[model samples]
Target: MARQTASQSTLNTDPVEQSPAESQTSQEAKKAPAKKPAAKAPAKRAASKTSSKTAAKPAAKAPAKPAAKAPQMKDEAAKADAVSTAAPAPKPAAEKKSLARRKRPRKAPATGPVTIGRSGFTKLKNISEIRHYLRTSDTPVFFVGATAFNLLGLDRWVRGFSYISYYDSWDGTHPRVFCPKDKPYVEFESGEQINNWLLRNHEVRAHIERRTPPGKRPQVVMVFFDEETERICEELDYELILPSHALRERLDSKIVTTQIADSVGVPSVPNVLTTVKDWDELVKVTNKAKLGQDLVIQTAYGDSGKTTYFVTSEAEFAAIADEVVGVEIKVMKRINNRPIAIEAVNTRHGTVVGPCMTEITGHADLTPYRGGWAGNEMFPTVLDDESRHAAVQLVRKLGDRLGKEGYRGFFEVDVLLDTDTGDVYLGELNPRVSGASAITNVTAGAYADVPLFAFHLLEYSGIDFEIDVDEINARWEELASEDEWSHMVIKHTTNSVERIDAAPRTGRYVLDHFGNLVYSHGDLDWHLLTNESEAFFLRIYPEGEYRWKGADLGILVTKAHLENSHGGLTLHAKYLIDAIRGMYRTTLIEGDEPQPKPAPAKGK
Candidate 1:
């Protein structure tokens, strides 16, 4: 039987209170005869400082109160009781009648019509105002994607937030997860297609219609979306909260990213951008930039690790002739560098940055492709003070530049740190929600303020608000060293297709005395994960599903580092990886077997 980890009430805990000014306005709005407040409104506004408090301190247990205060505490308590027990003098008959009249019950106030965004409202001035606005909002918001890996746990920050996914990672238990029942075994080529499929599903359409009221369009967000996604959203009367696909496509190119960085005074690795049809031209271009023969060549689009090629000789160049010949590509000199990734949001006020994390790539035990992104590790020592500060500046400059180009919302950038010189250079750009967001939202800074993605949602929320980007960035930088977190994306590392007869369930697990993984219990997410010994595993392809090379098997998250200083998997990480892989029972498919096909097209 599927177990429910967190109930709706527990997961929807509100961590906001109105500012003094707003509180006064709200109090007046309640008592006004034109718009009376609900009878239960006062209870809904009760204070719960569970997440809002001083966050500069480390995440250790709170310090115990001093013993000397015990007697004073008792005397204070006694005086409070004495004052409460004291009786009041009798009132005159006229005054008593007036008091009775004021205490009579009144009818509840009627709700006003829903407004998109925060139209016609005062601009927000600080984090407290921003938090209170989002907490009380009723606009329907949906995250549509292949999986909820990117923006999971964001529902805690925003009201009326939920997810619509193609993969059922929650095993039909999570209250907020909605997966269509008409799933057919189609080999999806990209995440965009998966999102398009979900948008067109009949069950998904009905679900959205049920929650959405008349004359209101639901707000939709996704990690990977294209023109087709925009068109489908238009047909369904839903709002796609992102920049145009054309702008994103242009900025997605590595060459374009390099040029933009250059224009904005951000440095990139020494390289030249040109069309190289042969080895001779490539050598000429590299020599022009004073780059050595050992080079990294990347095409205009696609991630560098997946599409980038290393060339030191003519033979190496010939290996990727089809992809490189006559196409615009970036050829850079190889350097001893450490890759770092950081996420930021370009808001109307300015750019707000998140923590810097080291990227984990190309571990043989984790992934099949070379230099493929396996996971990310975020700790205090991930970067020195100088390098970390430089990365934040680079991201801020890039975000400001993108804002000028009419692009805004969430984006991730790759920053290359030269281990030899301690200099930081800008890398590629991801103009949407990224895989690293899973760790970004759970950091100490996020708990103190709001998750980075909340700002992205605010951009599309249609509310007029303002924030001090510099203040937020400074506070986050100081709190960076107060938390430690890491996650590894376990993929099918073999070159064959197999059927999973037995697979581990998605939930919490603990290691026993022998360092073996043991199931502890089910969980809603990694937010409540406590120690290094406990891990939360989210399964992608569950039991009885087909697994292929390079396919994601699952994700393992804990409160410790998974990679060492030498950029390799730690011993404990290996143990967990091996144990999880050991539980999978799969059988290879014989040759000449046809692959699974999609269900018949509707009306065909």
Candidate 2:
């Protein structure tokens, strides 16, 4: 079939399919070309103008029939708009699903009409079967790909069903999936021309597009990423799942997950993985194996503890032992730590757990990689009770052995318990989404319906999934010991400065001019601000204006995400100086106005 319509017109880009459920499918309507509507050329006959009463003024028209109808005018105007993007008024079916738990009964609440993010939070009813999960693969595309996930409203689950990305862009408008504005605009200017325009645009691929069962066509196209993804799938073909390349090749030897945590008995950091390549045979193997008593070397790819060194003298190993050559360091013993963190889910129906976080790494060096993220606190006594039952049986036995090795999605493991031998080691394994998944997607067990990412997208979404992970961990440990709510990831201490520049006129009430609404996070997630149009900016903080060294200053959901002073790294640097001293300073209102928008935590 003409090589399958030139391989479905170069579906966005391709290449990367190791099977994993054929990557999910939807090659965007053959690279979105449907434009041919403005071609009526030959009408330029104004070459020789005329005046003489307009060339003897054409013989007066409207001369018969309609003479008396000229007085009929009933207009009645009612249309005003400067920039209207309305689409948030549906979602009533008993709050959209799970009046508590229905194996099958919801028929409302999806407000199916309005939308946003991965299509209105995946249609409510237990994520509305991911809107009928591709009715059995491919051809359900709707990705306009502009971003801001329609400002995080997720376009009512992406206009419910059907999506493929770049619907038609450069604002010319044709986006059933949204791509307007010169379609891919030079394929986004760089990253090698967006990987050569998604492998020369095989019609924006999801295996050449077809929609589903009716005729059959989804070969595959799943893409889930976070962090570097090597120039966005260099030269593209598709098939990507990057939990930082399996955390840099199976946690790139955290002494091989500490020898897979001593062959799955998990408990670490009293380590030693020496390899004296130089630095004078690593200083005689740290003085004949006494191994720097209270040390920590770890080079081969370090994060949050910066190439993990800490010699403690020899002038800190002579100003850092020639930067540990032949890398492979691992020399631990630096205890007195307590992170915890958790969010597993590797299912075919099994590894589904959530409540256990405890990070807040004191922003290691103020921010960015050096900032061991100083904010996280999911109660439940951080860990103890046999180290939270041996760290939830070591991440449900490492997510049931990564779902028998096929590896499912949404990962997060981090251990380290030892508050006096409550010994539970396994420190890291974020397959993805582990900055503590917004503490399990806005908890209260996702407003009482249970959405720790809808059980990690219903584990591979072939459904049939069951729950009762010890009855949702004893109903989220009896509703987190009766509502405690806590979250904090405040990284942005100064990027783009604005602790209070001045401005807040539009409907005026974000406080400051003595009012108090000086919080942040767009218009309203907590206080509900939307007058001039709410989104001042602060939920996950991704709009702009940032600084204070650089990187991360967005998470701060509260309620005791961590108690006791000095715990989650100086309480996230004193919770960013109590959210920059609760922003507050309004009543100025000038040209680009903007200011008054802080209000986090919440009011009863």
Candidate 3:
């Protein structure tokens, strides 16, 4: 790989320091004035020539203070340093008082998006408005961790932006702030816990003393799933409106999703619903539904194909039954369908769906399950018109229902198109702004909702809004299908349990040899460092006092694939994960402790 010249923001930038010779010259200049007077005092030795010029006045002149004082000052400074460090039991109270009285200058006030670490950016926009907003506002922002970050992208956009949003980068040390300054203090503990604390008591009592005045508090936008964001809002006496929360909860449930799909005239796979208490009844229902010998089960509201399951025997079902107690389970006929999912955005105007995505699956651990997932590829051979219409119908119906429920943001509805049968089924519906929302934001069909999810927050907040959903959807349709966009969130099939290492901080961006940029995450957190095609590390340690471990969460990539090249029943999807994992080095470990790093050579 070619090594490019380091940019100014890179670690290679150097700072200049004064040379020793320059220091000596400066020191000598201070002594010159004192020496001038000391030399004049020599008139006493030459008193016999006193009548010349003004030399007679020198006889009554004072001694040269400047030259005499210079040495004394230097000696005093040296003594002070020695005293401060060397004195173990005794020290002058006056010297200590003088030292403490020199107040330090406040650092440069950063006002804008936050950049991770000590990185500098090329340019920034919205400086004036954001600065005005911050300077005058009394509202406080809390920060949390575990950003929706996969790349260091967030560090670029959010480094100088605002008050902490309750939790910092989902990936690293602290809740990062762009508006005020980079606050590396948020990295301690879990981002989930910080957000939860806010929820539990509208204020972060331990760290801060007061709340942002009610009128000035900013709307909280939820880009990731954490139980506490809502709770904190309620406690603080602030309006915590995540429009997606209400709508997604309704549409997110499998039964609710299937029903909505049917209302919109979309068909689904044959399935039966089961609760925690009714395995036997579920069996009876499946038998009555007449699914087949092959079956698939789904736990409601999960991501990256974790909620999905395939079963062929009593034992397989039994293992899941034990783990997923009290959760709603959806059992369906195992159909030989090619897996395809799409990103959709439902604004106040209407719902706009992105290009089709084909999920990558089939790792050995998931062979028993068969369709185990690795990632998703967009532009997986376009779905036929019939299936496309079905997808539109499903999303539109859900969007309308969401409007009634006060949800107006970016959400993704998963559509499963059966290749063998030419049928469509609503596979999953993520009610909240989903992992695919970023793709939708940049689509030509979509107007720049570059900050799309924020609109959802506005709807639930005290703010009033009206949007032209139809226009947005039409525009979205044009852009969404024209170019293919894809994204995949990486997960560990063999998950660890022990907490090791530190958090992978978010809010930074990276590019490939092809020059494609990868964003940190939907939330600001974590950064992936890659110097070459093969050398990459997802640096996750955030500032502060918390510990992080597990199948170390790392980078996520969204790359375009050839049209219709990704869809398949099982064989095609299997290698994507193994291939992604192979691109970098990560060692699996027992439990939540961080993945073990390789030991360096003994003699090197």
Candidate 4:
């Protein structure tokens, strides 16, 4: 799921007494109602302070109840109880049935739209209204994930926004980020595992329960989740605001994506889906499709370059036979292509597409695998005008089809540009917010209107909205042509199990005249980065963590293109990688080292 950020002052100005359930009525109120005098301001201040403290404190800290703040706590508790039992309001029958089917527990049904501030009941008709609603919303939204990189800048746009992250990128200094301090040694095999572990942690749960307002369920979003995540969210009553895990899993499969694309008239690379038990069967399938001797085979699921296989000779197939044999694989003719990633949202209005970016993949200096996704670059001319239009159209079609298939919210598609034929082929679908979102949310379109993910929120926000999808797309295309942005995910590449004694801080770093990278300043997000000389680095494996082979070290964001037109690392990109790597210092764990030989010295 994609999260959004709004300004804090607007959000903290006045509390909306309306619940999400109460925001459905379309009635207009009578005019000439004089505004009442403002209520005591101290109470509001106290509540804000309490909420901020709870949100900023480390999860491991014991819940504090200072005597000086006791009265404020009591006031908050009273307000919560009052809101919960206020009334049993009426709601639209259809909306009632929908909420009931969702199995969400609420105190009452809403009869009419509650007035917000002194604005009375007004419908959200434009992007500006939507932005105002989000900024002023007091809803507690928790984006739980491995790290907060994908949705890092969201808090800036939404009040009461916070990130529950497993990786403490800010070392607990970030006011909106909360990472638990007591993590035990556990081998995490996937992003889901990390999220589940964080969800189950006592401190994390306490943090969520503490900041959530009374009579309101907290909203949770993540890039990777499963049924276990759903159950955990249910146990805590945190609204998992994304498509069902089962639906996402089904759509996540490469085979399923191909079928959906085909159904919507979106072209994928010439391919055949079949179970390959041996090299002979693979050959037969490829030959029947006329895919020739060289082919690319992919399993239903995997990340980066792990599950994708490329083969030409029997020897090459033999090495990965164990993985492909008896498994359903997508076999395609290998093409000389440039990989592109585009993010889109399935909104009630329609599907909204983000900028198309050139994918930086498999650079040995950045990643260990041949086809691994290391980063992405977003700039004008990534594709010609015609090709860009085609790619956007294809993504919109896929997103619309996904909505028809009972899936909604944020999704990313990998499209391959056939250099020979100028064709755009759907490569795969990531049915969730991905690493590419860092650039997607901060593009020229986002500044002019809103990020693609905000539309995802509107779909779930239960508020009616209208947009000219074509106009937005055309304007975004023009703005994207003038915008330049790039980001790289740096991973620990050495085959060693070492503990990080010191790691680079998560903030802006500038390249000095001597080419040395130095800390520029502390910042919460990279939107403040003004030039290529300065980059915002979000650290993943902080000090005291084990840095193993292929472990993510951090992420680097800049305005410069990291890869050239030929798909090789630019010289400046290489320099940035070396300088960033030089910031980390690690020492081998004691148990992993050889024992000393004292006996030989004594005998001599």
Q: Which ten contiguous residues of candidate 1 have the minimum total lDDT?
A: 73-82
Let me know the TM-score candidate 2 reaches against the reference structure.
0.26
Per-residue accuracy of model 4 over 32-103 as CA lDDT, tens digit each: 112211112111111101010001111110112222211101110000000010112454676434322222
Each prediction's TM-score against the native? 0.78, 0.26, 0.56, 0.80
Instruction: Judge candidate 2 at residue 357 and give its lDDT.
Output: 60
For 1-604, candidate 3 gives per-residue lDDT tens digits of 1000000000111112223321111111112231222211111111011010000010111222332222111000000000010112332676334322212233354586544222232221232322222223233333332332211232222222222332233322333331112222221122223333333331223223233332244334433322234534444444444553334445556667676666656667777776645456566767888976477776554323334566777777787775445666677888766656555555544664555655544433222113433334445246665566666666677666656656566566666666667777677665544444434433433323323433343233332234555655555544455545443333333423212223343334444454333333443321122222221223222222111111223333333341233333232122332333433343222334455543321210
Candidate 2 vs candidate 3: which has greater TM-score?
3
**Which sequence of candidate numbers ranks them by TM-score, best first?**
4, 1, 3, 2
Minimal lDDT window, size 10, model 4: 76-85
Error of 3 at 104 (Å): 30
Model 1 over residues 139-181: C-alpha lDDT tens digits? 7788986566667778788776778866677667666667776
Residue 573, candidate 4: how far off, in angstroms? 0.3
What local lDDT score does residue 312 receive in model 4, on the 0 to 100 scale? Answer: 88
